[model samples]
Target chain A: MRNIEVCFSPELIHLHELQGKIVVVVDIFRATSTMIAALANGIEEISTFSDLEECREMKDQGYLIAGERNGQTVEGFDLGNSPVAFLKKDYSGQKLAMTTTNGTLAISKSSAADEILIGAFPNLSATITYLQKQKKDVLIHCAGWKGRFNLEDSLYAGALVKSLESSHEADEDGALAMKSLFEKEGHQMKAYLSKASHAKRLQNHGIEADIDFCLTLDLYELVGKVENEKVRAI
Target chain B: MRNIEVCFSPELIHLHELQGKIVVVVDIFRATSTMIAALANGIEEISTFSDLEECREMKDQGYLIAGERNGQTVEGFDLGNSPVAFLKKDYSGQKLAMTTTNGTLAISKSSAADEILIGAFPNLSATITYLQKQKKDVLIHCAGWKGRFNLEDSLYAGALVKSLESSHEADEDGALAMKSLFEKEGHQMKAYLSKASHAKRLQNHGIEADIDFCLTLDLYELVGKVENEKVRAI
Candidate 1:
């Protein structure tokens, strides 16, 4: 039977061990959400970078830049970290060079995985369907707040575990715990997330709409997979 | 307001910042349980060490030695990682020098805190009472499975957070997520932990009773506090 595990934060990841596993990086509120939104809105692909300067350098190469630090838009960037910012944007053939505090860093660190997929509430069902079809061991990599576990990401991981529980066995305590949280509180994602630090941080920045948008389930039918340093629809 | 945060694993701890905070190190499977049991059984104090050699050396200095690695008792140790082993044993006025795979390591790493308290289900109410009286910020440091997040510790942390929720606020995502898990599964700890990897590991070793003992709430009325490298009742 395929097993499911959760890496609560990117810092706990052992890259070499992920070599043959399927990894789903969840960065709710809002990196993964933004990525899903950008993809659903017709952005062709997104190249993720850990450094803002690296993403900035891509601007000259026809990549639109989206960078954020501490929940604020990075200086001189085309977009902030809010998913709502990506709504209705037309980029059918354009590439996005994006950097965020946690999500991008997680993607960059998960290069050893056989396949890396972006996961968020907006494309949750699609992501689950994609994983269920793969039939490989799944590792939900939560892009926690700066190397610490965060509620929003874990909640998304819990939701994923809940979806996969019937067919997959939780491989560790982290996975079991996450699934339990989802079972208890998955019905009220937005209300539960309102108590999260990141949600409050974003709320302070007047992005409540983005929070609501990101928490919406199945907004997109596409799966975002990291390939050649870019996240593209698969 | 008193703020509660949980370091889901020892690896996520930022030692320098933990200074001046009230930190509770939890290793529910055995170490903290053992410590609480030893104290309740009249052991004078427990000196915790991350290095096995340090614990072994203390044996020569008249300290009762206990050591565990990978869930197994180390060779030449006086006791294994079983709290039941310490139960009912008369260790009056004798000090214990101990090392464990996760618990002792977490305690050693949290020495920078203003006050370091050992937490386990056995001493749950006592620890909670102590924390409530202290009326300071709390950080539940879970001794995860070798620097990785684990379920049992997080569940214990969640229980702590839940008990203190009326007066304390969860300061971060990890704490809130843990509390959520605790709220969901706290009532069925033994049944829930039976599914945990560590519990299975211990059961495989024919120590199922230890799992039961560790899950027993409020078995001891002592709060084990770390001071000068020793954990003693306060």
Candidate 2:
């Protein structure tokens, strides 16, 4: 059996060896969830940038510049980090240039991995199936809020580990703890995640609808893969 | 109400501002547990060092050198990281110089905090009462295994948060997740921790008794406070 490990935040990513492992970057509050939704809803490709100015400049190249900082859409960007917003309309034949407070930063730091996959509740089963087929060690890198731990991404990690338990042994205590957490709270994810700091932050912004949409599991049957810094549904 | 946050690993310490928070450093599997046991059983003070050589040299200054590396006792140490060993004898008036693979490193890194207190299951109530009296913003620093998240310390964090829930607010998602974990598994902690990687490592060293001893709740009614790098019961 292969091994599964969880790095609770991008800050803890240095403790993990990314090479030869499948790194699943998750920002369940928005970023990765939006990427999966955008790709699954007919967006051609998603290119991630860490700098807001850099991401906004993509509009000049005929790209739909999408980015958010601190949960609000950056001025002049086409969209904010909302998975539900991405599903509102079809963008077939269009490319997305994206950045966010946490998600894109995590993706940028995950370049050394053998493969990078975007993970969130939207593509849970699809990502599981993809990892099972690859048969490599998996590392779930959570895009916690500003280098601190967050609940949504960690709960997603637990969900992945629970589904992959039979095929992958937990490589550390973080994995085991997350697996137990999923087992305890998986059935009531919406209620449990409502207590998360990010959830409250979004609620303060009157975006409770987005939080609910992001927590809906297995909404898409496609997996988001990152190649050469661009994400596409596979 | 004061806020309670958890830093799941020493590596994540930089994400937190420790200058004003009351930092509670925990290594539940042994380090802090043993420190609590030692102080409760009458050891005058415990001085911690991260380097084994630096800790070992304390023997020349009439201090009892107790240290461990990788779950095993280093050569020329008086004791391994065992709470049970400390409880077996009265070490009244004796000073202890100690080092461990994870715990001491966490304590050393927490110097910027308003105060540092050693936390473990054995002194759970004492520490809780102490923190409640202090009424400061609290940060639980888990001395995770090799700068990675560990179940035992994080579980202890959950226990503290749960007990302090009435008077403290969860500051971050890590604290919230840990509170849920402790609520789900606190009653059966011994059985639950049996699955932890550090627990397995200890079992491999034929120290199953140590694990049980470390998990025993409220065995001591004193808190270990670090003042000028020397830990003493206050």
Candidate 3:
């Protein structure tokens, strides 16, 4: 059986071996969810930048620039880190350049993995199906809030690990604990995550709608794959 | 209200500001549990070393040396990382020099904290009472296996967080998640921890009794406090 583990935050990613594993980078609050929405809704490709200015400069390259810092849209960026914003319009063949506080940094750090997949609740089933078919060691990397553990991303990891358990044995305590967490709290996700610091942060920003949308499961049968630093639906 | 946060692994400790917080270092599989047991059973002053040789060298200075690596006792050590061994006899007035794969490294890395307290299920209530009385921000540092997240230490952290919740608001998702975990699994700890990687490792080493002992709650009301690298019951 393939092994599955969870790196609770990008800060803890160094303890993991990424060379031969399928890394599912999850930022459940917005970044990965928005990427999934963007790709599924007709954005051709998504390139993530860790720096706000670098992401802003992408507009000159005809890329739609999306950036967020501390849960707010960066000033002067074309778009913010919201899945609903991506779903509002079809970009058709346009590409996106995005950055966020945690998501983009996690993607940048996971460059060593054999394959990087964006994971969020919207594309949950598709991710599970793809990983079940891939049959490789899996590392679910939660893009936790600023290198600290977060509830939503880890719940998604737990959900994914629970779904993949038939074929993949959890190899670390993080995975096991998360799997149990999902089992205990998966039924009332929105209510459960309402206590989450990130959720409360977003609520304070008056984006409760985005939080509800991001937590919605299996909205699209889309799998966002990272290739050469750009994520496109596969 | 005082805030409670959990650093899931020692590797992620740098992301946390330790200066003003009470750092509760926990290695529930054995290390901290053994320290609590030793202190409760009449051992005086435990000094921890991260290096096996350094801990072994303490024997020349009349310290009862204990060492563990990957859940097994070092060949030349006076004792392994088992709380049961400490309870077998009273080494009254004797000092202990100990090293373990995860616990010692966690203590060594947590030197910047205003106060370092050893936490385990055995001293769960004492640690909570002390933190409640101190009225300071608390950081529960789990000495995970080899700088990775582990189940047992995190569960103990959750128990502490849950007990302190009336006076402490959880400041991070790790604290929130673990509090929930302990609430869900605390009643069935032995059966729950059987699925943990380190527990399986210790079971493989024929130390199932230590696992049971470590999971025992409130066996002692001793709070092991670190001052200048020496831990004494206070």
Q: Which candidate leads the pack in DockQ?
A: 2
Q: Please provide TM-scores, in order, for all candidate models, with all chains considered together.
A: 0.96, 0.96, 0.96
lDDT of 2 by residue, B1-234 (tens): 999999988888988899888999999878899899899888999988888899899999999989777667889999877888987889999999988768888998999999999999988998999999986999999999888898989999999999999988985788889998998888998888777666777789887788888888888789999999899999
Ranking by DockQ: 2, 3, 1
Model 1 residue A11 CA deviation in Å: 0.8
DockQ of each: 0.67, 0.72, 0.70
What lDDT does candidate 3 reach at residue B83?
87
Estimate every model's Cα lDDT from 0 to 1: 0.84, 0.88, 0.88
Tens-place lDDT per residue, model 3, B4-107, is 99998888899899998899999887888889999999998999887889889999999999987666678988898888998888889999998876888899
Model 2 chain A: ten consecutive residues of lowest lDDT: A193-202
The per-prediction i-RMS, to one decimal, reads: 2.1, 1.6, 1.6
Residue-level lDDT for A141 in candidate 2 = 96
Write the residue-wise lDDT of candidate 1 on A52-171 in tens digits.
898899999988999877667889998987788787557788888888768877888788899999998888889888888886898999998778788888888888988987777885
Off-target runs (Cα >4 Å) in candidate 2 are B70-72
- True-vs-predicted CA distance for residue A133, candidate 1, Å: 1.3
After aligning candidate 1 to the native by TM-score, how far in Å is the CA of B129 from where it should be? 1.2
Candidate 1 chain B lDDT trough over 10 residues, lowest sum: B11-20
The better-scoring model by lDDT among 1 and 2 is 2
